[model samples]
Target: MISLEEFKRSFKVALWFMFLTFPLLVIKVNPIERTVLWKWENMAFVGIGAFILSVLIRAFFIQKERSRNSSKNKRRFGYIGDEPLVQFILREPKYLYPLSGGVLIFALLFPALFDTYQTNIMTTALMYVVLGLGLNIVVGLAGLLDLGYVAFYLVGAYSYALLNYHFDIGFWMALPIGAMLAALFGIVLGFPVLRLRGDYLAIVTLGFGEIIRLVMENWNAFSHGPSGISNIPRPGFFGMDLSLDSAILYIYYLVVALVIITIFVVNRLQDSRLGRAWIALREDEIACQAMGIDKTKTKLTAFALGATWAGLVGVIFAAKTTFINPASFTFLESAIILSIVVLGGMGSILGVIFGALVLILLPEYLRVFSEYRMLAFGGILVVMMVFRPQGLIANVRRTYQFKKSTKGGDS
Candidate 1:
C-alpha cells in the first residue's frame, strides 16, 4: 500500500539528494579546456533513483512494523515466530544431508566449472571465510573489540615472506610456522590488554597494528622497505611442476579444504567448554569470573586461537599473490574483516560464510559500475545497519528444553 504521505516524504528525499549531489553528479568542469558542462539528465537520474530508494525503504519499514505487531500478538497467545529457513533446513537431517551433499559437490567441482580468475576470486573469499571464523572467536563469542587483528595477519605474512626469502622454507612447513608465530603474537598482545575493555582495548590493538605496519615499512633490511617481497612461491603440489592455471586450481582446492577444516574446528570449538567460557566472558566478565572461569586464560586463548586462523590465512594470501607488502596488511583490511563478522551475524558459522562471500564477491562483480560501485556498496551497508542491526542471520544459541515428569509433577 503506497500512501500519499509516503510519496510526499520520498519526493522530499529525492529533492534533497538532488540538491546535495548537484555539483558532483549534475555539473562538470574542465580546467585546461576552460569548459563547463551542465548535465541536467544526471540530476533527473539522481532524483528518480533517490525517490525510488526512499519509497522502498519506507515500505520495508512499514512491513517490518506490521511483522512486529503480528509477532507481539502471537507471543501474547503463547506462539512464536518461525525459525530462520537455514536453521530449519540444518536441523532436519533429511533436508540437511541432501543440501549439504549438493553444496559440497558443487564446491568440489567449482574450479572445473569456472575460469582461473573466478577460482582466484573464490579462493580470496574462502580465505576471508577462515579469517571471519577466527575473529568470530574473539569478537563474536568472546565480545572483544579488536581493531588491530591485521597485525597477526601481518605477522603470518611477513613470517612466510622473510622465512622463504632467507631460509628457503616451503609452504607446507611455513604454514604451521606462520600460524604458530601469529598465535604467539596474539598471546603477547593479550597480556597488555588483560584489564582493558571496549574502546580502550580497541585503541591499544589499533596502535599495535600501526606500530607493526610502521616497523615493516621502515625496516629496509628486514621487509625490503615499501618495495615489498615479490616472486614468493605458491604452494607446491607433490614436487610437480604446475603451470599457472594448474597452480591456481591447486590453490583453490587447497583453500577449499582449509575452509572446510576451519568451519569444522570453529563449530566444534563453539560447542566446547572454552567456547562457553568465551561466550560468558562476552556476556559478563564479572559473572563469568565469579563462576570460576579464568578470565585471563579465557581471554588469552581466544586471542591465540583467533590469531592462529589469521596467520594460516595470511600465509596463504602471501602464497596466492606471490607477493608481500606492508600496504597489504593495513587497518582497512582489519576493518573489512571485522565488517564481515559483524555483517554476517557474529558467532554464527553459516552467517560468517554468507557474509564473506557477499562482501568479497559483491565488490568484484560491482566493478562494472566503476566510480559508482563504492557509493552503492556504502549505501547497501547503511541500509543493512538501519534495517537489521542483528545481521543477516543472527546467531541462534543452543538451549535445552525440559519436560516435567508425570510421576514427579506437582498436583
Candidate 2:
C-alpha cells in the first residue's frame, strides 16, 4: 500500500531520473546538419519507468523492515542459506535430484540445440565458472583476498601461447605444463605475502598482476609486444582433423567435462581436512594457527590450488580464441572473476556456476541495449548488493548433533 508520502517520493525519484537521462535518452544531435531533436516521449517513458521502479523498491524495503523486526521475535528463524526459491527447492531431496538431473541433461544437449555462437558464449561462461571456483578457494573459503589472480591466468595463457609458438607443443601437452607453471607462479606470489593480510595482501597481489602485464607489454621480443600471439591451436581429439563446427562442439563438451570435474573436486574439498583448515583460517588466522594449523602451508596451498584452475581455463581460453594478448588478462578480468565469486555465494559451487552464467550471458544477450547495457548492469549490481549482500546462495556448513543413549551409555 503506497501512501501519499510514498507517492510523492516516487514522483521525486521519477523527476530525477528524467533529468539525469534527458540528454542521452530524450535528445539527439545531428552535428553535420547542425540540428537538435528532442524526443519528449522518451522523457515520459523514463519518468513512468523510474516512478514504478521506485515505488516497488520502496515497498520492498518496507516489507523487509517489517520482516526483520518480526524475525527478531521468532524463537526459530528460517535458515538463510540459498536464496528463497533455491532454498525451497533444495530443502527437499525429491526436488533437488530431479532439478539437478534436468540441468545436467540440458547442459549436455545445449550444443545440439544452439548454434556455434551460443555454444561459444556458454563455453566462455563455463570458463568463468572454473575461474570463479578457483578464486573461491583463495578468497571465499580461505578468506585470502587476491586481486591479481589473473596473473596466474596470464601465466597459463602465455605459457601455452609461447610454448606452442616456439616449441610447437600441442594443446594437450601444454595444458599440464601451463597448470604447473601457474602453480609455480602462485607459490612465487604466496611466499612474499605470507605475513600480509586484508588490504595489504590485496595490494601486493594487485601489484603482482600489474607487473606481469607490464612485462608482457614491454618485452617485445619475448611476448610479441602489443601485437600478441596468434594462431594458437584448439584442443585436438586423438589427432583427428575436425571442422570448425565440430571443433567448437568438441570444446564445449570438453569444458562441460572440466566443469563437472571441478565441481566434484571442490565439493569434496569442502568436506576434507584441508578444507576445514582453510575455513578456520578464513574465520581467524591467529586462532587457526594456534590450533596447530600451519598457516604457511595452508596459505601456499590455497594460492597454488586456486591458481591451478585459472591455469587450466587460461590454456583453454587461448586455444578457444586462437589468439593470446596481454590485454586479455588485465586487472579488469581479475575483477570480473572476483565479481563472479562474490555475486555467487562465496563458498558455494552451485552459486558460482549460476553467477558465471548470469554475469557472462546477460551481457551478451544485452547487446541489443548496447549503450544502456552497462547502465542496467551497474544498477542491477547495486540493487543486489543492497538487498542481498550474501550472494545468490550462501555457503552452508555441515553440522552434526550428538544424541545421548537411552541408558546413558556412550553410543
Candidate 3:
C-alpha cells in the first residue's frame, strides 16, 4: 500500500505532465499539407497514460534500487578479490587496451552490423559525440559556459560548402581548411568575452551564434539563403568507384577513426599540463591567474581547440548531408552539445562518450514518446540537479571531492 506522501508526489507529477501534454496535443502543423490540426483527445490520452506509467515505474524502481544497492553493499566483501594485482588490472586505465581494442573493432564494423536506417542513426550519434568532445574542452575542462559554439560548426560547414562549390575542393582537402576557419572565428569570438563568465558569457556566445546563423540565412549571394548549398562532395579514398553501401560503410569507418583520434587526443589533453591548467582556471580564474597562467593565452587556446573540433564536425556534417543551411546550425544544436557534456560528466573522458550516445540514441529509440521528449528532458535535468548534480558518471576527481565533502558532514 502506498503512503499519503507517495500519493501526493505522484499526483504532482501527473499534474505537471498533464500541463506539458496540453501544448503538444492542442497544436500540430502538418508540414506536407501546410495545415494546422488540433487533437486534444489524443494528447489527453498520451498525457494521462504517461503520468500513470511514470508514477508506477518510479515507485517500483525506487524500492528495487534500494534493495539492490543494499544487497550489493552487503555482498561486496565476499565477492571482491583480495589480490592487489587483480584489483589493479580491474581499476587501472592503462590495463584496458584489450577492452579498447574490442570496442574499436566493433565500431569499425558497426555499419555492416545494422541496416541503413540504424547505421545512419549511429553516424548521427557519433557526430554529436565529436561535438560534445569539442565543447568539453571549453565547458568541461576550461570551466567556461558557451552557448554559441554552433557558430564554429556553421563556419566549418559553410567554409567547406563554399570551397567545394566554387574551388572544386575535395572533402579531404577542404576539411582542414574549414576547421582552421572555425578556429580563427573562435579566437575572434574569444577576445571580446575574455573577462566575462557564467550568464554574461553565455548570452554573448548565444548572440554570436545567432548572428552567424542570421548572416547565413540573409546572405543570399554567398550562402544562397534558405535554399542551402547542394551537391557537396563526399569523402573518398584514392579515386575508388564505390557503390552506395560501400560509400556509407567508408564514411562510418572514417568517423570511427575520427572518434578514436578524438578520444586519444582528449584523453591525452586531460592528463597534460595544459589540461591541469584549464582545470585550475575553471576552479577559480583569479587563483589560476595568481599562479602565473596567462589568462588571455590559455583561454584563447582552449577556445580555438574546442572550436576546431566543432569545425571538423561541421565539415563532416556537410559531407554527410550533402548540403549546408543556417537552419542546421542553430542555438538548439549548441544546447544539445552542452547537454551531452554536462550529462556525461564534465572533465570525464568516458562520461562524455557515454553521455553523447545515451542522449542522442535515447531520443531516436523513444520515438513513441516523441511528444514527451522535451518534458522528459526537463525532468531529467531537474532530477540530475537535485540528486546527482555532479553528473550521470562523475569523474574520479569529482567523486573524490564528493566523498571528502561528505566525510566532514555532521550527519
Candidate 4:
C-alpha cells in the first residue's frame, strides 16, 4: 500500500495515458447546438482517472502474474473454472441440459415479454451469433484466420436477391440455392490458397473480399450499378403478408430457430471425426498430413461449411432489410465477424453467443458514443489481446487429477 516504486511506475503509466486521452478529452463538439468547447480541466480529470485505473490494474495483473508461477497458488486454486458458477455446468451435461433448456424457454417467450425494439435487437444479436459461429468454423476450429469471409455473405445475398428479382423465386426456394452458391464460391476461393498460412493468407483473402466487392460495385448490368436491388421479397407464410411487428417477431423466431440449428450442427461437427481432423490440422498441418488428414479436402470443407452459414445469414439479412447493395458487405463486416470469433473464446459456441451479445448490443448501450463505438471496440480488442488473449470465457479442457496416497494402508 505504501510502495514508492509502485507509485513511480503508476505515475509513468498515467502520463502515457494522458498522452493517449488528451485529444479525446480536450475537444468537445455539440452538434445540436453547433458549438465547440475546449476544456483543459477535462484533460486533468481524465489523467487523474487514468492514474487511478492504472494503479489498480497494475496491482491486480502483477499479483496475478506472480501467483501464476506459484505452486501453492496452483494447489489452492486448483482450477479457476471449478468455481461454483460454471463448475457444475461444465462438468456435467445433466446440469448443462437444464440450463440450456431454461434459456430456450426464456427465448421462446422473449418477444411476449419485451417490446418490438428489444425484439429486433435480440434478433440482430442472434444473426451475429450465427455469423460468429460460421467464422468460428474457419478461424476458430480450423485456425485458418480468414479475413474474406464476408465475401461468402455477399455471394449469398446477391444469389438470393438476383434469383428472386428476375425469376420471382420466393424466400424458401432462394435460400438453398443461395447457400449452395456461397459454398461453391468458398470451394473455388479455397482451392488456390491451401498452401499459404498466417499473414499471407490473410492478405489474399482480404484481396478476394475486395475483389468481390469491387465486382459488385462496378457491374452495372447485374447489380444495378450500386443502386442495389430494392423491393426484395419479404418473408411470409403462404400468400398472407405479416405486419411490421409480426414480421419482426417472425424473423426473430425464424433466426432463433436458425441459431439453434446452427448450434446443433456446429456442436455435432466439433465432436465428430471431421472436427478431430480439423483440430489436428490446426495444431500441426504437416503432422496432420502425415497422419492421413487430407489438406485440400479438409480446407475446402472448412471454407464451404463456414460459407454455408454466412450465406444463410445473408439470406436472412436480405429478407430483414429488403434492400441489397455493395456498401452493405465490406471488409469491415469481415473484421467485425472475426472480432466476434476472437473476442469470444475461439471454437466455443457459448462463448460466441456471449461475444455476439457484447459486441453487437454494445453500440446500442453506448448510443451516446456511437461515433466512438468502433474506437472503443478496437481498444477493447487490443486490451484483451494484451491481458487475456485466450478470451473472456475460454473453453477449458477437463483434467483428471490422480492423487497418490501419502502413506500405505495397514492390513
Candidate 5:
C-alpha cells in the first residue's frame, strides 16, 4: 500500500512519460502532415493528448492512493480526516463592488483601444453576460434547468422586428412588449412542466425551442421562413439614431449601462426574500415546502424572470445585429449560455460576467487557428473542469465583521 504523496508522485512520473511521448509521436512519426492540418492543429493535438493522458493518470493514481490509504487505516484503526473543511471569508462590498465597477467603466470609456472587430465581439460578449445573468436566476439560484431559453430570445427579437417593421414602432417602445410576450410564453410553458423533474423537464424545454424554430421556418407568411427579418431598427438616444456615424464608444456605453442595470437588479433580487426562497428550493424542495415556501410560485417566478432577461437581451441583440433569423437561436446557443453559468460558478453574479467573457471572447481571439478553434475551445473547457470544477470563481460566503459590543463600564 503506497502513501497518498507517493501515489501522486508516481502519477506525475507517468504523466511526464505521456507528455514527453506525445510530441515525439506527432513530430518524429510524421504520420500526419502539418499542411493537411490547420495552422494550430499540431499545437492543439499535443495539448489535447496531454490533457487526456493527465486526467487518466490522475484518476487512476488518486483512486489507487485512496483505496490503499483506506485499507491501511482500517488495519491500524488510525484516524485520517477525509472530510472537506468548510470555511467562510468575509469581505467588504465597498472594495469588491468598486473594483468590478471600475473594470466596466474602463471598458465603456476605452472603446478606441480595441479595433472595430474587437468592439463588435465585446458587444456580443456583453449580450451573453446579460443573458447568462438572467439564466443564473432560474438555473443557478432556483435550480431549474431550462433548455428552451433561446425561445424567449427569439420571441423578443422577432417581436421588436415585426412590430417596428409593420407598425413603425420605436426600439424603446418595442422592448417591453417583447419582454412581456416572452414572459407570457414562459408561464405557459411553466404550467405543464410543474411536476416534471430533471431530464424530463429539460426534454420538454428542448422540444419547446424546436417548436419555436419550426414555426419560424414553416410559417413563412409571418416569419419569412429561411430568409428571416432584416433591417431591424437600431436603438436611439435622445432622438439621435445610432448608426455608422455613432462611434463604437456610444454603443459600448449603451451596453455598459444595460449591464450595470442588470447587475443592480440581480444583486437586489439576490438580497431579497425571493432569492432566499429560490436558494432554499435549490437545496431541497421538500425542505423548502416544510419551511412554508410556495414551490409553484417560486419556480414560476424563476422562469418568468429568466425569460424576461432573455427577452430584453433579444431586443438589444436584434438592434445590434440589425438582422436575425431562426438560425441564430439554436440549441447550441442555449448550451453556450448554460456553459457560462456553470463555468462562472452558479449563483455568482460577477462569476457569470467573467465566464461569459472567457468562454465567448477567448475563442474569437483565437480565430487565427481557424479549423482548430473549436478543438482548442473544447480543450480549455475540459481542462478548466478538471482543475477547477467548482468554477473559475468558487462561491464565497460573505460575513460582516464589526467591533464587538462592550458592556457599559461600572461607575
Candidate 6:
C-alpha cells in the first residue's frame, strides 16, 4: 500500500502533467478562429476544463489520504501521538462593523458608476436578499420549509395595488397595511400546517401559493384575473414624486434604506433569545419542546416574521415596477427565492445576500449570449453546488470571549 505522503506526491505530479497537456490538446485542433473563439466557446471550454481538473485533483488528494490511512499499520509512524496545531486569534467586535459599513458606503456613493440596467438588476437582487433573509428566519432558523413565501409577496403587491386604486391611498400608507395583511395570511396558513411535518408541510404551503395564484386568476372581481393590475403607484419621498425627475436615483436610495433596515432587523433577531430558540428547534423540535419552548408560538412567529419581510419587498416591487400581475408571483419566483436561501447557506445573512446577487445578476451580465444565457446560468449553479456546497460564504462559528480577572483566574 502506498503511504499517504507518497500517494499525495504522485497525485500532484499527475495534476501538473494534466495542466501542461490541456493547452497542447487545444492548440493543434484550431477548431475556430482565435477572435471568435475568445467570444464564448473557447472561454467556456477553458473554464470547464479547469473546473474538471480541479475536481479530479481534489478527489485524488482525498483518495490518496484515505488509502494512506487504511494501511497505517504497514507504515512506520514518527510518534505515538501527535497533537494538531491550534492558533487562537483575538477578533474585535469592531471588525464586523467595518465590513458592513464599507459595503453600505460604497453602494451609497457609487450609484453613478453602475449603469441603469445594472441598477435595475441590483434592485431585483436586493429584493431577493430581503426575501431570502425572511425565508432564512423560517426555513433556516425555525426549520420550516415554506413553499408559499411568494404568496405573501403577492398579497403585499395586491394590497398596495387595490388600496391605492380604490381608496387613493399612497404607497407609504399602503406599505404597512400590505405587510400586516401578509402576516395575517402567514399566521392563517401556519395554523393548519402546524400539525404537519416535512413533506406534508411543504405540499400544503405549495398548495397555498397555487391557491393564491388561482384566486388572482379566477376572481376577476378583485384581482382583474388574467389581465391583472396595472399602473401601480411608485414610491415617493415625503410627497416629492420620484417620477417627476431622477426616479432611478430616488428609487436606488429608497432600496438602500430598506436593505439596511432589513439587515438591522435580521441581525437583531439572530442575537435575541427567540433566535436561539429557533436554532434549537431547527436542530431538533422534540428537544426544543423538552426545553419548555412552545412549538406553536415559535413556529407561528417564524411564519409571521418571514411573511412580513416578503410583504415589504412586495410593496417595493410594486412601487418599482409601477405595475404587477399574477405572473409576477409564480412558482418559479418562489423556487428562485428558496434557492437564494439554500445556496447562500441557510442561516447566514451575508451568504443569502451573496447568493441573491450572483443568481440574479449573473444572467443579466451574460445577456450578450441571450440564447445561451439560461444554459450558462444553470451550468454555473451546478459548478457552484459541486464546488462550494457550503455556499459562497460559509457560516462563521460564533466564539464567545471572556476576559480573565487578574486576581485569580485560569487563562
Candidate 5 Cα misplacement greater than 4 A, ranges: 1-90, 245-248, 398-411
Sliding window of 10 residues with minimal summed lDDT for model 3: 77-86
- Candidate whose TM-score is highest: 1
Which pairs clash (backbone N, Cα, C closer than 3 Å) in model 3? none
- State the lDDT of candidate 1 residue by residue for 1-411, as single tens digits: 779999999999999999999999877998989999999999999999999999998998887676666753354222234565677775678998898789889999998898889989999999999999999999999999999999999899989989999999999999999999999999999999999999999999999999999999999988998899999999889877688999998888888899999988998999889999999999999999999999999999999999999999999989989999999988988988888898899899988999999999988887877788657757767877987877777888776555566444322
Over the full model, what C-alpha lDDT does candidate 2 score relative to the true structure? Answer: 0.90
Candidate-wise lDDT, in order? 0.90, 0.90, 0.84, 0.87, 0.80, 0.79
Candidate 2 ranges beyond 4 A from true positions? 8-50, 69-85, 88-93, 406-411
- Report the C-alpha lDDT of model 2 over 54-141, residue by residue, as the tens digit: 9998998887776666543343235443235567676568899899889889999998898999999999999999999999999999
Model 1 misplaced regions, further than 4 Å: 8-50, 71-81, 372-374, 401-403, 406-411
Of 1 and 3, the candidate ahead on TM-score is 1
Candidate 1: minimum summed lDDT over ten consecutive residues — where?
72-81
Candidate 6 local lDDT, 1-411, one digit each (tens)? 335665565556555655665565444444465332223444445555665565566666676677557553443333122311110111344555676678888888756777776777787878888899999899877889988889999999999999988998898898899999999999999999888878899999999999998899899998888887888868767887665336766777777888889888988898788998888888888989999999999999999999999888888888888888899999888888888887888888878888898878876777788898657656766877886776666555455545666454322
Model 3 TM: 0.79
Clashing pairs for predicted structure model 6, backbone only: none
Each prediction's TM-score against the native? 0.88, 0.86, 0.79, 0.86, 0.78, 0.77
Could you tell me how far off, in angstroms, the CA of residue 390 lies in candidate 4 after the best superposition? Answer: 1.1
Residue 1 local lDDT, model 1? 74
Instruction: Kindly report which residue stretches of model 3 are placed more than 4 angstroms away from their true locations once superposed.
Output: 1-90, 93-95, 398-411
RMSD of each: 4.4, 4.5, 7.9, 6.1, 8.3, 8.7
* Model 1 TM-score on a 0 to 1 scale: 0.88
Candidate 4 stretches with Cα past 4 Å from truth are: 1-43, 62-88, 397-411
